[model samples]
Target: MSQTLRVLGTSVTLLESIRQRAEAELGIRLQYQVHDTQTAQRIAVMHPERYDLYDQWFHNLDFVWPARAIQPIDTRRIALWDEINDLPKLGRLHPDDRLAHGSLPCDRLFVQPDGRLGSRPGTQISMLPLTHNADSFAYRPEHLPAALAGREESWSWLVDESWCGHIALQNDAAIGALDAALALQASGLARFDNLGNLRLEEIDQLANCLIDKQRHGHFAGFWSDDREASALMLGPRVHIQSLWSPTLMQLHRAGVKYRLAVPKEGYRAWFGGLSLSRCVQGPIKDAAYAYLNWWLAGWPGAVMARQGIYIANPLRTRDHLSRAEWDYWYDGRPATEQLPGSDGLPLIDPGEVREGGAYAQRMGHIGVWNAVMDEHNYLVRRWGDLLRTAR
Candidate 1:
């Protein structure tokens, strides 16, 4: 009899292809409940018993870890733990690379002897770091003002009054607040001591500035998922906005002429991985471990790489990708020929190069990571006010 592993996460990793592959290879039945970031976090924190594993971001640990919703993963159980790169293990690919601000995965990776999460190395981990990338907004070059066509792309553009009424932002509070803060700071409208974690006054001041913009019709709408983001970007409703890697691939397949900006300020990065639900044990727990191991395996990482995410074990993933894919996506070289996405559809043009260059260069430029702020509760309420007032 096959034991069912109930997995909860966003559509990014919980794809139909992945589910089918896992069941066929691991001999376990799988059940997936995919939700947007906000809803998934709410469920994982409040009702941990409903799922066997939680596939989400590291920043989310602030909520789930404190709620005791997840169990630490033993490194020995991870088949390819030794092969994993230093980025998640040490918080930087190279020792000299400064850690990006926010809730970095390494900062909360290990399980301390006292049963709390910390950066110091240990045999147990809060989550197995998997797919990750540096994120920035994209825009349709043709839609931009002619004067700005040759100018360097920037986060400040998100706040520029010239682009007001045509901009959109991702709707989640934590991620969106950081996006807005970066924009505000870049445009010289506001300053923050730390972009990742906002103080109470910073939250209020940021919200007030955004609310004022909302009254003047600064935003078209806020999107909670890729579908809404795609709609806003594809239609004439929005010219530019915050975007994820997968959404960019979708746009490429649809033949949208968009530019994923290499922002002057730097990218807002994120790391996504899987964690064991607190209630999972015995055979179900073993199956859960198998799933985590499967993610680090070559094929799965290749699938995610087609959409621009970098797997934690890059060398293993490199084997599964074609030379053109390796050159274009990882090495930052122009594509020798059109490359196919995970769905087998052409996603890259022959002469096109990735926006921010090679993996090392791109990862080195991270400004702030997606985070759960210290004043997250207050931020949420104020964000809600911004949303309500915007509509």
Candidate 2:
């Protein structure tokens, strides 16, 4: 009997295609456990036996690694090991390109002989890099005032008094704080010394500002998952909110008119990948390696490409994608022909241009990464308070 490889992650990585292909091709039974970022992080650290693999953003390392909940993956086991993008290896790119502010630092990506994460070159990694993308807010043009309809995109719009009671924000504390800080900085409400690793004072100031807005009816709601976010856009009718690329894609496919803003301040970037649970061993461990290898094999990357995420190894993904798909998704070219969504059904019509332009252009504008700061515990406490009392 095939052992079930229980995987825990946010909804983003639980793609139907990935599940179907892994079971059918790799011959492993998968049990996907989806949770919000915060909850998932907690479960992975405190309940390792419940899962065999953890797929989440790099910020998770701050919490998961110290708890010793996950084991480092041997690079040799990953079939595309050499093809994987290692920030340390890419000397030709600009410094910012090599290390975005909010992403995992190059020094902490590898496993040292002592079983701790370090920067030195090694055959083991904390996580196998999966998909990454830049994120920003989306808005319905029809909901904007005529004066601001075509105005320059700004994060300030999220907290703008003009849209009070018509806006929504993400429920995830770490990322939500980043978005709030960006808006605060853009609007001159407050400033942070480091937006990515927000200090306690900075968190308080920003959270206070958001709570004030909430008290004044500045928010329509907070969404915990993609479906909730999509529902907010369609039901209660949120005009603006922090959005994920997949949610934007879903809205577009449903014929909802929206535009993903290229905020003047820059985009909040994020990277996610797969990691092995400390409890996994023997056949389960072998199967986990197989699953990680499959992700880097190209087809999975191609499926993620349709959702606006780029695989860690771009060159390999080319083999699994059509010319038009590659051009439109990565090169920023207008679609030369109708394109398919992650489901392989036609979604984009010919001539539709991707938001934020090409991959290089979008990536070049990363202002901060989704991150867990030094004050994470405090932030979570206050964030919980905001959720309960903000109304």
Candidate 3:
């Protein structure tokens, strides 16, 4: 009998494509019910026993635990759980490229192939990495910031004194945390110094910049939503901010011009990978594994690239790609078939992704990052307060 796989995925624009892929894989076609993340969370909790797998933005790992709504993953039962064969290939995946299997974060205390890892919240040997990416500058105009500095182009220039207040940034920590960390890193103001864990001081810097720019009448304001950011940039209230490719692609479809930049110091990013659900039964698990392997090998990456959304699996090579295709896939080249000006040419040398200095996968680690950033929200709220007080 064909086994059924009940999975949850984000309702982002990629929903349709992801659904089609699952249908093709399961043969029986998955019962994919799309909902906002909140609804998905409720479904996961109410029917943990019923779900074969709960697909989410990896950030779901944060709530998965506190809500106590999941089954323990059966590592021994997973048919493809070959350590020697899979771990090396997966473990060696670019640290930020946590979207692949077999890799763990910094060997921290988790139920991983290595041993008990650290205290990074739900990452305690639970959950799995699904997809990962580095946050970089996505812009148009082709005026490379690093080049203007007599340096290579970079997304980090938005944080510099020269740029002052005109910048774009994502409000979601998972999406924009790395970009904040890099901006702070450039100013020597931010680092993983807090608790020796990767940290980002996003709010303070943003507030200060907001205040500074207001004082000089040079600041435009930090963007809180992707659509809003794009609109502002289109209206030209904002010129730049860190953005992921999916949104950039949509903007391109809207006829907005821009490019993606993997800065010299490296772009900051977070990623997730797929792990079979402990609740899954029947041959579906093997099929899921097949899908996972295929995804890891790069079908999803290629598809995402076509949509201007970059996924992690570097080895996941696409078939019959032209130079323009490669640009959109690996080099941040624009989807030239549409956005002719956006040829997302490489701005700087970010080194190879296979090496370290890239993003590290933090499976089931949404809570830790959230707790840290929640305190950071004081700054965000404070920015609002400042605008209010001024009025």
- 1-391 in candidate 3: lDDT tens per residue? 2756666654432256665765676465666666644566567766666566666544445455445565444434333333212222233334553332111332321354343334333323444444544446665554334545455555446656566446655544334444555555555654444311242354555455445545654335445445556676676555666665456655666666565554665544344444345566558766555555545444555555554443443444445245555654455433455222122333222221211122222221111221224343454365464354323
Ranking under lDDT, best-scoring first?
A: 1, 2, 3
Point out where model 2 deviates above 4 Å.
Answer: 87-99, 103-107
- Clashing residue pairs, backbone N/CA/C < 3 A, model 2: 102-369
Q: Looking at model 3, report the run of 10 residues with the lowest lDDT sum.
A: 362-371
Query: Measured by TM-score, how close is model 2 to the native structure?
Result: 0.95
- For model 3, the local distance difference test gives 0.47
Query: Among these predicted structures, which one has the highest lDDT?
Result: 1
Candidate 3 or 2, higher lDDT: 2
Cα-based lDDT at residue 82, candidate 1: 94
The TM-score leader among the candidates is: 1
**Which residue pairs in candidate 1 have backbone atoms (N, alpha carbon, C) closer than 3 angstroms, thus clashing?**
none
| Tens digit of per-residue lDDT, candidate 2, span 198-283 | 88888899888888778877888888888888989887558899999889888989999988999988888877889899999999
Residue-pair clashes per prediction, in order, are 0, 1, 30
lDDT of 1 by residue, 196-298 (tens): 9889999989999999999999999899988789888999879999999888988988989999999988999999899999999999999999899998889
Q: Which candidate model has the greater TM-score, 1 or 2?
A: 1
**C-alpha TM-scores of all predictions:** 0.98, 0.95, 0.61
**Residue 70 lDDT in candidate 2:** 93
Q: What ranges in model 1 sit over 4 Å off? A: none
